[model samples]
Target: MYDIRKLVQEIDKEHYLNELEAKSKKSKKDIQQKMDKINKQIEVLKTRKKKFINMLADEKIKHDEYLEMVEDNNNELAQLVEKKNEMLSMLESEQVIDNIDKLKQELLQFLNFNELTPAILHHPINRIDVKEGGTRVINYRFAAPTFE
Candidate 1:
């Protein structure tokens, strides 16, 4: 069975890429606010794991109880790490690359270089093609740009 939620989320990838660009232009405080929220979640996970370890260190706790605490904390930490990695990879994938390429093309259009011919800009000296007597001759008399 096809899951509709997964399909919707796939469509949202483009929206998320745009959000990344907007965030880049946003205020530093706004950016840090969202980043701090993520850091808080990570800190909470670490603190919970620390408590699990501390609880297990008590001499009164039974061996099975200690093992259970350690196992639960380890599982939670593993899940968090996996989720973070998945998000990171999604942000780094080919869809984002294509989105960035499109954005660059748009920006280059604004730069007025999008329509320039490569042949005119590529050579230091402009050489007019000459074909005489079925032979080609190189002309180096063309004036090129100079910097003082």
Candidate 2:
């Protein structure tokens, strides 16, 4: 459990982050495909219910049979909708890897300075110009960090 190799992909944080993003994208695609399939199934059930109604109107099927078939169709639709809800929940809960570059920069800052302070914020700046509309202009020092 304490093994770093087990926790990350090949001991490279950038590579690990990229791999996570790729896996997340693939999982989203798979869930989207499954939801598409469920949507198709729901459409078919709806079409079947319409046909059931048409059969009753045409006197080809009895009222009782039409009701039974419609009930069964609705039940199947409900089940599929439940499945779709589950997939949606999974999609919402799925971990997405975004802003990897920003993450890497933060991680590097953490590695360089374990604790954050006002001094750290002011270290690589010439001056900060505050503007009127919730905007600020930042001036950088000649020795400002380039993150190279």
Q: Pick the candidate with the highest TM-score.
A: 2
| Tens digits of lDDT, candidate 2, 33-122 | 999999999999999999998999999999999989999999999999999999999888664454444544543453366676877766
Which residue runs of candidate 2 sit more than 4 Å off their true CA positions? 1-12, 99-148
lDDT against the true structure, each candidate: 0.51, 0.70
Question: Where is model 1 poorest over a 10-residue stretch in terms of lDDT?
Answer: 139-148
User: What does the lDDT come to for candidate 2?
Assistant: 0.70
What residue pairs are clashing in model 1? none
**Model 1 C-alpha lDDT per residue in residues 56-143, reported as the tens digit of each score:** 6766577788778778767876776666666555444424333554544433343344455664344322354667776744443221
Candidate 1 — which residues are off by over 4 angstroms? 1-39, 94-148
Error of 1 at 148 (Å): 52
